[model samples]
Target: MRVRKLTFAALAIATALSLTACNDEDLTGQADPSSTSTGSSAPDDAGSDGSGGSDEEGGKGTVAGTGSNENGEIGKCRTDELEITASDATIGGDTEGTVAVEFKNGAGRDCALAAYAGVDLGTDSGMISAERAGEPVDTTILKDGKSIFFGVTYPMNDSGGSGVRVTSLVVTPPDETKSVSIEWPGEATLPVTDGGGSSVKVGPMGSAGQGEG
Candidate 1:
């Protein structure tokens, strides 16, 4: 009787094991056709490599839109800055008078002045000394003396045009956040030598030129 009981107990355990070894569907009901194979969860597919593609990437990377300016020179100093000072500076324009403007660079990168254009040495400060267009026009940095324009405001808008008299202008462009403005007064003298080789002297309106009436 003890041997039979022992055999019965072994049989019961084996039967339980066999039942558990069968498929889960067999234990419950019919297998769901639409159910995933292996009955495990599926993997996700956000697809993006998360590496943020390069600007010139053809397709492997996901490109994005960014803000940019055509005329903004706030970034690295452009090689063209020196050129603009010597000629048609969209930065500074228009001046009236025979005056000499010298530039002193304080630090940072190479740079020029952005000043008012067409500022006649004959006008008094109380009067509308000069007109400034949009923003001021910037001057170019040059190794030698630069021939540039100043103090005349135009129809458009820019940072390179501020119609105030400036002298001994010390421009510190190499600084991180540079502040561009006139520190001292710019003097206006009569034309001693014209680009056309004429001895044209400026007539002061009581306040523009040097001492004496």
Candidate 2:
């Protein structure tokens, strides 16, 4: 009878030990929620056009001029009332291959221009939109003869000597949808291709004080 009681006691202890081991295993095997990944990988063609793989992909909303629509006192500059022109800008007393685009109020009235203007380069493939460089500054008040300027920075050193020749520029004034296609001032060319490092950055709009040249 004592042997039977000892055997029963050993069986109960073995069962208790087995359950404790299973509980420990369950606690250790649980996955840490913080380390688990959530999102999928980015597409292979991401940032191919130098758009940084965001909402600016395929050149849509590349130069998001959001701050331009805030001023309602002087009214936004209309596309037809503004005369747009481009010229080779001399950066730091030397032409560092930058283009200065000028906007003048030719409609014999006063208008306002704020934030970055939408810009795109005319290439062989299609229009390559420019990315916004810096934040918007003060509103540019354009009188009949006054002008506002923005600079376009691009890679100009064509090592292969067969760069993409930029023939024209598609410009959209602040708060306007109608774009104007102006011939690229001077023979401007980029050293990169369409899908390859073909990046173009545009500064915000400002008067002559904002480094127009």
Candidate 3:
């Protein structure tokens, strides 16, 4: 009975040692929540520091008409900075004729222009009305020494018994109040219906060398 107790006590001591080693192993295997990684890292945000890289693409970088005058925005063409001239009239047939009016930019800097020019064809009696022949083009950037042309077409008949002779032609550039006048180029005249107003058609402004008629 004493030998049996000694063997049982030895087995109990071995079991206690094994349980202590297992507890130590479990404590070592546990991870700290703060230092452990959960998943993949997040991506970085771009251009959040107010740099100009993204602002340029979004059209918010620099304001126009700022800094140097050369770099500033371009304004409308002024009358003082332009040279106006007209071509001789060419009769299409017995009924219609066309003449081209040219505007040359004489300014030291660039400017912008668009739309049809205002024209006044006056006879000995009174002023004649005119209308735009076609739609206006997009805004044209006129650099120094550049030019644009527009055409004016009118009735050329003088044998309608009420035909009035055209003597002078007055031209005003777009967005300008001042006007320039020159003598008529040809002998074209318009028919006056029962003393009513006569009409001429003007084309939209375009680059030089283009077909104006």
Candidate 4:
């Protein structure tokens, strides 16, 4: 009976050790439901790439229609904004004479002129339109308080009896309908028939030195 008690005690101790090991394993293996996760869920930074470098580098490039000009807008010049005048331009080159016409920008803003200015010589009979001379290669910008120039060419008549007598000039800006009238600088008689072609012709608009005179 003493030997049986000894074996029972040994078996009880072994069972108690096995239960303690199982409780330890259960405590370590199970995850806590209330605790936060270790993995990140935040969004990536906008300026940084994954390699820790920035995505953007420099300033913006130039945009369309925004040039070096002030006010950043360019449009056709209007007739009402101009102060038109005429003067006697020196005629020296090929053969014929030309009248220098200048357009001053009194409008406090900027504008542009392309192609020829429409010109008409006012006579007692009717209005005679002058023909356009050259093709427009560039758009002339008339800045605030600036002036643009062009020329009106005509055949110089040694014998003055053939052509219509012109007393005033009715001028119109490019791509404009309304007209402005200025007195003719000198007496001119533009012929109605000059070798079956138009007698009067106007050239393209230009800056100061590039004018016809």
TM-score of each: 0.24, 0.58, 0.60, 0.62
Candidate 3 segments whose C-alpha is farther than 4 A from its true place: 1-72, 89-95, 158-162, 194-198, 207-213
Better of 2 and 4 by TM-score: 4
Question: Backbone clashes in each candidate structure, one number apiece?
Answer: 33, 0, 0, 0
lDDT of 2 by residue, 1-213 (tens): 999999999999999999999999877666443233222223334545444755455345533444344433677789999888888775554434678888878878788787889999998756789888866677777777677788877766447686777778999997889999998874566766547544788888852234432
The C-alpha stretches of model 4 lying farther than 4 A from their native spots are 1-73, 92-95, 160-162, 192-195, 207-213
The sequence of per-residue lDDT tens digits that candidate 1 reaches over residues 1-213 is 999999999999999888787866574555554465434433322223333333337442332222233333444332233222111122334443233323323234434333332232232232222323345433334223233333221122222534333232222222224423333333332222223522212211111222111
Query: lDDT by residue for model 4 over 100-157, one digit each (tens)?
Result: 8898887888888876889998877577778988666677788888887888877766
lDDT of each candidate versus the true structure:
0.33, 0.74, 0.73, 0.74
What is candidate 3's CA lDDT for residue 4? Answer: 100
Ranking according to lDDT, highest score first: 4, 2, 3, 1
Decide which is better by lDDT, 1 or 2. Answer: 2
| Pairs clashing within candidate 3 | none
* Model 3 vs truth, CA RMSD: 8.2
Q: Stretches of candidate 2 above 4 Å error?
A: 1-72, 91-96, 193-198, 207-213
Instruction: Supply the TM-score for candidate 3.
Output: 0.60
RMSD of each: 15.1, 22.9, 8.2, 6.2
